[model samples]
Target: MTIAVRTFSQLNEAASAIASDRDAAFFGGGTLIMRGINEGHAHISAIVRTTDAEFRAIRTAGSNFEIGAGATMSDVLANRELSFLHEAARAVGGPAIRNMATVGGNLFARSPYGDFTAALLALDARVAAAGSSGGRETPLADLLRDRERNGHGVISHVSVPRPAGGAEMRFVKVSRVKPKGVSVITIAAYLPLSGSRVQGARIAYGAMAPTPVRVAAVEQALEGKTLDASGVAQALAVATDGTSPASDPIASEWYRREVAPVHLKRLLLGQPA
Candidate 1:
């Protein structure tokens, strides 16, 4: 299939034109799009570039942090204000791939193994989109659900609240090589502590499920608990329970199940996985 490329000087115009054509798509850094075209996974007549969109700025919008759709992973990593996102950005592809993968592209790609989505989930991020109906905000989880349910539209930005209280976070990915190996399991944890007790806890697991999911049961069980070895063990148990991980050439379900609990325990206790 042949794909035609187009450029836009403004986002409103781009959104209007793409909405007029059902098969049209917006291009970002083109890392995923180019690969999909090469692999026969994506075929479309037209591609619209986001270079002219005002979606490249990373700034505070009210109390929430907004990241422009066109912002590259490299840009996010270099921003001192986006420390959590920076950590996640560093875990994306290597130098060249990182330079080419954009935040909006990664979120829309909807790959279950994508590190950025998992990190966003951990941050409780929301996606801002501009479509034929104009613009709106949707929770990241809901957006992923909609993308899976109905493939359409362009993501204009992503917003996340500056976490309140004493927030500590950790990300762990198990792979043979940092850059290319499919992660056996990726875990992201965020803990907001009060005194010696945990005021809030969020744990998200990726590559071990169909999508990045919050370990709600585990999070609830750990909330208000003293951050200790015993609590960590229990949280890990709940976190790994009922996971539906698929076996692939690189790893097995048994291996993921085995590693998940142990890693979760380590992360909750502020120890490295």
Candidate 2:
């Protein structure tokens, strides 16, 4: 079957196009949607895209950093202001895939591939989208939870507050292949410290569940605790408490569960895996 492609210069028009056609999929970097089409996925008969400048813009507002939905991984890598995300962005894919992968598209990526989204989750990011009901912003976790029902709209941008004083962000992707490979598991943590004690810690993992998830049990264990051996040990004890990793060619579910706490411990201690 032939697929029709539509491009709009206006955000609302693009949203309308998608809202009106159930079979028309929004094209961000074309990394995900296009692959489905090429694989003979007949559900998507049309492609909708946008050329609006805001779709690819990246900027900061006070303590918040916003990245447009169309911003590619390469875009993130080139922005010095987004240096904190460089590791996550670089972990996405090699040069070619990075050039074609968009930040918004990453949110819709399936397990093991949404490493960037995992990092965003740790940062407590929010996603903005335009739909038939108009534009709105939702927490990344909420959106991911109901992605199919809530993700059909045109994504506009995603924003995250910059880590505050005494806070640090860390991201790591575990893969069997070097440089670029599907993730075995990915971890991203945002640790806000009060004199060495972790406060309001947000830790997220990819490929550890159907979607990237924040470990509340582990977070609670680490809260108000120093990042000493004892603190790290406490987190490790509950690391896989709520996780339900999937078995895939990249790694078995059992393997992911076994290594999750190991990696989480290493990440917290700033040690190499």
Candidate 3:
């Protein structure tokens, strides 16, 4: 069975229904959910679909971004306000898949799949949600760290603040296909620079760990250093340190470790990877 919820109230009702039933789950976009269901996950007997009016919006004003949970990748690509994220959006899928995937669903996606969430993480995004208890806001990093604890609520919105002055936002993904495909490694970052030196940085890498990871050591290494070839080489070397990735068919841990610095170099230098 599946429930289509049109309003927030209806969404709440559907959520209540799922809470009481072990076999039910919230379905967003059907992109990832259907894959699992087809793989013989018969336990998911019902879904609370989020393709209703309540969760379909893309609002951007000034430097603030507010995307509804159900807003699709197509919506993201079309918004000029989100130019910084356009690269990530294009990396999501082809036209049809992009039209079907939702922003909220990407947040809960497991490793190697949610490259867009990696971008959001680097951008310091936050999520707004409503649970039976009440409404709340949580940092995207915190949510990613403890998915189970913060995931049982209905997501109303995802937001990112404007970067500080002189901050440059960038995204890069290494994929088998240029247009539509999963990434071998994806990197997103916001680098705040002062003159020729980096003051701060938020860099997120996907498919390099159990979840998208940000290397604080890399950020610290880059701070107070010029954004030149020498500085980049040094920071890139530090970027791959302290990572934990399991070997997978798509790419081995060694491969990811070896190339992460290369991708990071490209992203930070604004060169195509």
Please tell me which predicted candidate would have the highest TM-score against the true structure. Answer: 2
Q: What is the C-alpha lDDT profile of model 2 across 1-273, one tens digit per residue?
A: 878999999877988988888888889999888788778764777899999998899999788998998999999999998988999999998999999999999998989789999999999999888653434678999988888674458778898898887899999999999989899999999999999899999999999988888889889999999887787888999989898899999999999999998999889998987
Candidate 3 residue-wise lDDT, 104-152, digit = tens: 8888888788888998988989888644344466788877787766345
Local accuracy by lDDT, each model: 0.77, 0.89, 0.77
lDDT of residue 51 for candidate 2: 91
After TM-score superposition, the amount by which residue 72's alpha carbon in candidate 3 deviates from its true location, in angstroms, is: 0.7
Off by over 4 Å in 1: 110-112, 131-135
For candidate 1, give the lDDT of residue 170.
Answer: 77
Residue 271, candidate 3: Cα error in Å is 2.6
Q: Where is model 1 poorest over a 10-residue stretch in terms of lDDT? A: 144-153
With candidate 2 superimposed using the best TM-score fit, by how many Å does residue 269's alpha carbon deviate from the native?
0.9
